[model samples]
Target: MKTLVMFGSKSDANIYEPLKSRLLNEGHEVDFRMISVHRSPELLERELAKVDAQVVIAGAGLAAHLPGVIAAKLLIPVIGIPCAAAVGGLDAYFAISQMPFGIPVLATAPDAYGSAVDLLSRWGRLDLQYTFDSFNIVMERHKRGLPHFQMLLTRAQAIVDRTKIEMKISDRPVENALNICLVDINEQDPEAPMPYGPAARGSDEIRIFVPALSEQAYREAYAGVAVIRRVATVPGGIWTGINNVGNAMLAALQLANAQGAHAAFLTNAKKGYIHA
Candidate 1:
């Protein structure tokens, strides 16, 4: 498999080098480059036009536009790793995760190269693989009816009401149905368990995380899931500037719907006052 790894600045070597090495070790044809979407737009466009890779992994920070720009130019899957350049990397995370409805840039936690690799593996582009035995155990406990699970369902219900998306909560993945699971990471416990069983069970299931103030929740969730498969982190910080619940929910809906369904969905969402 061929993989292209790009970053905004050469100083980001510390972030992208290990991922490149890991791809090489996994017997992938790795093409590493330093192309800034802002500083070198023309060059970036030129490179992307001729690029021949199964997937692209881009890392950037502080209004990270590299991944989104690449995704716009390429039809292949583009995974974004938001670097810790500003505001605990929340700015970059939102910039990547909150892309427009049609163009999707799979956003992961800061420096989350493992998640990128795992996504590639799941796509059958790599030989490496992972098992979800522990994740399944955690989900089993949630199935037995945990307090937190109830809380998550309540929150999900609220989100459903607001977004008006036809979705349901299920222990197993349901075909033609939007399967979603909500996990709250707003607690102070750093060692808290993040049960991402729905994500592990199906690639189509969307996992939404309400991150804590310290942003440790994002790290923990990314570490547990370790893949880009339909995962999202809602807008969160000390001030909570914007409510991105609608965006995340719409994104999930778009992913669930057919390919050309984005335009209609985006139009209806706008009419319904939902930010898409």
Candidate 2:
């Protein structure tokens, strides 16, 4: 509920104002201050001890060590927002990002305030969260023939569409279009009857790349839906199948990024694909 935001210089106030306003709007206590690590180390330390907060976000430019220093002193989570003060902020970003073990600083670009907000929102689970396992679990759940898989597909479509528009992608489908492949459960297990048929359930709105064998059947089965006969394998087992999907999503995201598209790619695990 309480957040302590420290900016290294008064000149960086413009960068801090929006984040401060966002936290205030969310009805959280935001203590904003300008404390330089180099100029006023003692004052910064004294003020840090005085402040009581659930999370601390520090902004610094040019060899930014404020967030790392804050993390070194406090047990609470520290998020670093690298300012574009020197070398377009790359120097500051590396400063906080390359913290030694036992001291962890969450690094983000100065413009990515939303990333900080998201971290703060889920600050309580920061310590307990296993990021790799979390991603694997998402894939595992999808393999059980659950609805989350369909949800992920829908979210991926939205991301692709938004990115296309933002990047001025042509309406005509080209070789460069982000290809989204869907697993053919029936093909993988011919004996087992697929409840949703060729494609997964609730996947009516999005484009799905199907295996060559079941391409015609899926097209006939689901009218008005886009289905492609692309080279995609649907290996047996829940984990293997899910890994295939994750790989496909990652490929699509990479293509989108390569095309200079505006994509949030991994906004949330339950909602969209996480770029892990």
Best by lDDT: 1
Clashing pairs in 1: none
Q: What root-mean-square deviation over C-alphas does model 2 reach?
A: 18.8
User: Least lDDT summed over 10 consecutive residues: which range in candidate 1?
Assistant: 128-137
Candidate 1 local Cα displacement, residue 103, angstroms:
1.1
RMSD of 1: 9.1
Report lDDT per candidate: 0.54, 0.48
Work out the TM-score per prediction.
0.57, 0.47
Q: Write the per-residue lDDT of candidate 1 for residues 42-61, one digit (tens) a residue.
A: 99989999987767889999
Q: How accurate is candidate 1 locally (lDDT)?
A: 0.54
lDDT of 2 by residue, 29-64 (tens): 898888999999999889988877767888888878
Candidate 2 regions with alpha-carbon error over 4 angstroms: 124-276
